[model samples]
Target: MPTLKINDVEVKVEPGTLLLDACAQAGFPVPSYCYHPTLTPVATCRMCVVEIKGQPKLATSCTTLAADGQEVFTESPAVKDGRAGVMEFLLINHPLDCPICDQAGECKLQDYSYQYGQDDSRMVEPKRRYRYEDLGAKIVIDKNRCIHCTRCVRFTKEISGTYELTVANRGSNLEVTTYAGRSMDENPLAGNVVDLCPVGALTSRDFRFNKRVWYLKPVPTINRHSPMANPMWADVDKNRVWRFRPRPQGTQVSTHYMFDEERLAWHRYDLDPAVRVATPVLRGAPASVEAVAAALREGATAVVGQGTFGCDSAQRLGDLASAPELRYGSGDRVVQIQFPALQLSSDGVLNRRGFSERGYRFGHLDELLAKVKGGEVRSVILLHDEAFSSRAEAAKLREIVEAAPFSLVLEPIPGELSGLATATLPVTTFLEEADFVIDHEGVLKRYQKALQAPKGVKTVAAWAKELAAATQAAHA
Candidate 1:
């Protein structure tokens, strides 16, 4: 450990920790555009300069390591002047179109300019201009607002390993662009570059000009499409999710970025609560939860819960089975791309470990099917979502449901098996409920409710409790 004084406050950090990070630990954060925890520290922005007691020149805190007994001043006169100078040069050719820019409210250049920049510019020459260029169907590049931080270029090279973006030309004409004007559509993680941009130079094609950043409130959530179940923010307005972004956790580099599929997965959950299925259906007609529960309790019942659901959902679904061993697991989707840096597992089932720990047996669907057809298990209760299941796995589940004499399907979204069941109950989606899950590393991650469920819709846990009580009362 090394003890350092940042802005007159003493702090201790592990060895090899960056001075910029140490300063942040001490509550005096030195801002920088090119210094991301996940990316290499380029120090090209020159915005994180700090004055060292014995150093002759102001040192870049991003590249400097903290040392014992070191005294660093982040807000000294010399450091302030240097930052103001850097801010001035960065704005020399930058456009003043913040009103129309997508990054207006969250742009670093705008914040730093108001804090450390001069009100007037020294250069009278007209600002350099270039028409916005589309980097394929995913991103749009506006060179006029660029600050030349090279963060996007480094992201493609280091994190995604796509090497699709690069910096072209010299000092005054430096521009970030794709190689040979190639499109970024082939890059599975291309949308992350837009997040790395400190200015409005890079914008997502899907989200640009759609809505202002300030109007949307970020709701903490998790990526259901990811195997790691990475945390994310669902930017919602008026109960509609507009977009998703990586929610970084502590110093873990993998949490700083996500796959494009995960980034855009929120669209699948953006259902119209007004039009969503709000009531239980029995034999293709409207019915009550009691009716569905009565039909399911006719004989011995077996439960098959997909591993993509929350731990609370799994616990309640397991209780529907006649015995503990009657609980089965489902879901067999696998992610093809294996980005070793970010993805922890290739299996797409997010909460398989959580379900397995709750006495839910996986990879035994065939055995369960045999028991259902042999008149041992007369009824089946399935808690499923089709998005996380493969066609083959879905076919197997459909067979199991159809073989049972009385089957009750519970789903947030209606699927093929839901149509085959004797009865179906509409449940609230994960976004509309609050629950937690255990990841591959046994880490308990909790997600809060981001949307309001419809009037008649309920969570799996809530529905399961009602069904259990109704069935017990009927027996009594």
Candidate 2:
């Protein structure tokens, strides 16, 4: 460790750490545009300029390493002036399209401008313009807003290992683009570039023009799309999920960015207002939750709890079965992701590890089916989400649940099996519940409420606990 003074506050940092990172670790946030942790630092963006004791020129703090006895001034007048000058350069060609751009509220450029930029610009020439171009189905590139930081280019080279994006031409004509006739749709990690861009240069087509960034309330959540249960930002507004962004833990190692599929999974929960199940139903007719729970308690002799649910939901679903051993595990959607030390999961059901920890057995659906056929298990209760299960697995699940004499399906959103179920209890989606998920590695990542469950719907665990108490009272 080497001791360095940042803005006069002395701090020790591990060797080889970037000066900007060391400053950030010491509670001094260095403004940076080209310095993503996962990308190679080209020091193209001069946003992180800092004054050193002996250097005549302000060096880029992001690529600079601190040495013993180094005195760095992160907020000196000289450093401030340099940063302001860099901000001016960045805005020279940037289109003032914040009103229409998706990254307005969350854009680093927008924040840094107010903090370190001038209110008026000196540019008298006609502002540069470039038409918005689709890089692929997943990403849209706005060349005019780009600051030529090369963060996207570095990302494709260093993180994705694709090296697809490159700076073509020189100076004002330099543009980040994929090879001729190539599309980013082939890159599973393409969505990450959009996140890497500090400005509105890169935008997600799925998220663009849908919602303003400020209107979204961020909830720290885990990605259900990965086996590792990667931490993520669940941005919601007015009880609807608007987008998902990577919220990397300091050392969790799931990349500084999330895969495209994980980013897009937010769309699946787009509550279809017309199709959204509003109330608990008993054999397709509207019914009270109490009535549905009571009917479920009487009918279900076994349960297959989907592992896509949170730990709390798993516990309650396990309790719904006739016995603990009768509780089976579900959800077998596997996604094959091969990235460099990131996106660590093939199994899409992130909470499966948590559910299994609670005594639910996987690959044992046959045991439940045999029990149901032998008349030992007459009824079944299911907590399910069709998206987390593959078509083949869903077919198998439908077979097992339907095999029971009385099938009670609990779904947040109405599904195909809702019609087959003798009783259907509407349950809350993951966003509606305030719970935590333990990843495969036993990391208990807690997430807050992003959206409110529709009227007449409650969390899986709440419904189960209430039913269990009611059943016990009836028995007593």
Candidate 3:
């Protein structure tokens, strides 16, 4: 451990901690652009300059390390003046596109300018300019607004390991661009550069000019499609999901960024309420939960739960099984991921560990099918999501559902198995319900409900409880 004095206040930090981080921990965060916690710190921005007691000149806090008994002043007169000078240089060639810029409300450049920048510019020369260019279908670059912080460049090299972005030219002509104007479409994590940029220079093509970010309320949630179960935000407005952004956690570099697949997966959950299955259907007609429950309780029931769902849903689904051994698991889809640092497992079933902990056995759906066909398990109840299940797994599940004398299917969206189900219940999507799951690391991650389910839609847990009550009443 090392002790330092920030603004005359005593602070202790772990060895080799950056002065920038120490100042932040001491309650005086310095402004920075090129200093991302997860990325390599180049200290090129010069906005985080601070005065040290024994140093002749102000030092860039980002590149400087805290030492024992070091006296650091984050808001000294010289440091403030140095930061203002840096802001002046950064804004010299920057454009005045704030009104039309998508980053207007949340831009770091705008915030730092007001705090440390001079009231007016001293430049007599015209501002440098370059027309906005499309990097690919996923990203757009506005060179005119770039401050050459190189955070995006470092992200591509260090984090994504896809060196698709680089700085071209030098000095005033320096610009961040793809190699020989190559497309970024091949980079799966290309969308993250937009998040890395401190200014409006980089933006996502899918979210460009869609809606002002301030208007969209960010709801904390997890990436259900990701095996890491990465925390993310569902930016919603008017009951519709507009976009998804990575919700970074403390010291977990993997949480700082997300894959483009998970970023764009919000569209699947932003389903149209009008077209969604709104009510319980029994043999093609609207029915009550009691009717569906009675039909499932007709004989010995075998349960199949997809591990993509939350643990609470798994626990409720397991309660429907006639015996513990009758509980089967599903969701065997595998995804290909390039960045190993961002994701450890490629298993598409994010909650497999959670379901397994709840007594659901995976990789044995074939046995359940045989039991159903042999008349040993007279009824079957399946909780499935077609997106995360392989064709073979889905087909096996379909055979079990088809073989059972009576079947009940619970799905947020109807799939192939829904057609053969003796009864069906419309369930809330993951976004419409709050629940938690245990990941491959045995870490419990919770996600809150982001959207309200349609009038007749209910969560799997809610439906399961109702069905259990109905079964008990019948016996009573």
Candidate 4:
């Protein structure tokens, strides 16, 4: 370990740790634009320049390694002057479009300018301008707002390995663009460039001009679209989710980025309130949850739980079955992608490990179907999300539901399976429920409720507890 002083505060760090990181660890975060931990550090943006006591000139902290007993000053007069100069040069050709820029509230340039830049620009020359260019259906690039950080270009080349983006031209005319006429639409991880951009240059077409970032409150959540169940933020406003952003775990490269499919999955949670199941139903007619639970208690019961849900919910749903062996798991829809570095697993079920740990057996739905056909199980409760199930798995579940003497389906949204059940109950979507899942790597990740569920819509655990109470009361 190397001991160093940042702003006169002594700190020790591992060998090879950048001064930028050492400063941050010492509670003095050096402003940096092109220094993402997962990406190779390029000292293009000189915002993190700091004064070292022994060095002749202020050094870029991002590229300078910490040394034992070294004295570094992050807030020194010389460091401040360097940062101000860098800020001035960066803003020279940048457009003053913060009012309409999507990255307004969270932009690094906006933050650094406020902290280190001069109030007025010295350059009276006209700022460079170019019309926004669509980088396929996913991304839009505005050249004027770019600071030439090359974060986006580096992300494509080093992380995605697509090599579609490059720095075109030199000096005053330099801009990030695709090769020749190639579009970034083919890249599964294209949307990540928007997150990597320190300025308003790269933007997501799906989220562009939709909502201001200041109004969106970020809620910590996990992406269910991938088996990795990657951590993310669900930016919600007025009880609706606006977008999903990658919430990278510290120093974990695997969690630093997410696929475009997972980023766009926020739309699935922004379902129409009118189309959601608001109350429990009995025989196709609206009824109380207690009524449905009482009806479900009359015969030998089994449960079919999809592994895409939380562990607590899965455990409670599993308890509704007559015996330990009666609980079965579903959801085997795996998505195959070209990148193994990005895609951790082909298993689409995010919480299969959680459900399995709770004693729910996978690939045994057919056995449950056999039991239902043979009269061993008379009542069945299915906890499911249609999005995670395939057509064939759904069809097989439908067969089991139709064959059972009594069936209850718990779903967040109304679907065909709900229509076939003897009783149906409204359940909270993942966005409206707080639960934890053991991901494919056997790491436990928790997601919190981002949006409010419709009135009378409860989580699976809540409904199962109520149902179990109702069943007990009927038996009593």
Write down the TM-score of every candidate: 0.97, 0.94, 0.97, 0.97
- Each prediction's total of clashing residue pairs, residues at least 3 apart in sequence or on different chains, is 0, 0, 0, 0
Task: List the candidate numbers ranked by lDDT, top first.
Answer: 1, 3, 4, 2
Give Cα-based local distance difference scores for all models: 0.90, 0.82, 0.89, 0.89
Off by over 4 Å in 4: none
What digit string (tens of lDDT, one per residue) describes model 2 on residues 184-285? 988988888888888988888888798888888998877777677777889988778988888976755573678887788888777866567767677668
Candidate 3: segments with Cα more than 4 A from true spot? none
Estimate the Cα RMSD of every predicted model relative to the unseen true structure.
1.3, 2.0, 1.3, 1.3
Candidate 4 lDDT at 172 equals: 76
Tens-digit lDDT track of model 1 for 72-158: 999999999999999999988887899999998999998989999998999899888875666888888888888888999999899
Residue lDDT tens for model 3, 1-476: 89889999999999999999999999999899999999888988888899999999999889999999999998888988898899999999988889999898999999999988889999889998875666889988889988999999998889877788898888777888888777789888888988888898889888889999889999999899889798999999888999999999987988888888889988788889889888899998999988888888777998899999999999998998999999999999897867778878889899999999989999998898888888899998899999998889888888888888889998887888999899999999888999999999999999999889999899999998999999999999
> Cα deviation in Å at residue 440, candidate 4?
2.3
Report model 1's TM-score to 2 decimal places.
0.97
**Steric clash count of candidate 3:** 0
Q: How accurate is candidate 1 locally (lDDT)?
A: 0.90
| C-alpha positional error of residue 406 in candidate 1 after TM-score superposition, expressed in Å | 1.4
For model 1, the superposed segments whose C-alpha errors exceed 4 Å read none
Residues forming the 10-long window of minimal summed lDDT in candidate 2: 291-300
Compose the digit string of candidate 4's lDDT tens values, residues 319-353: 89989998899998888866777787899999999
Q: Least lDDT summed over 10 consecutive residues: which range in candidate 1?
A: 126-135
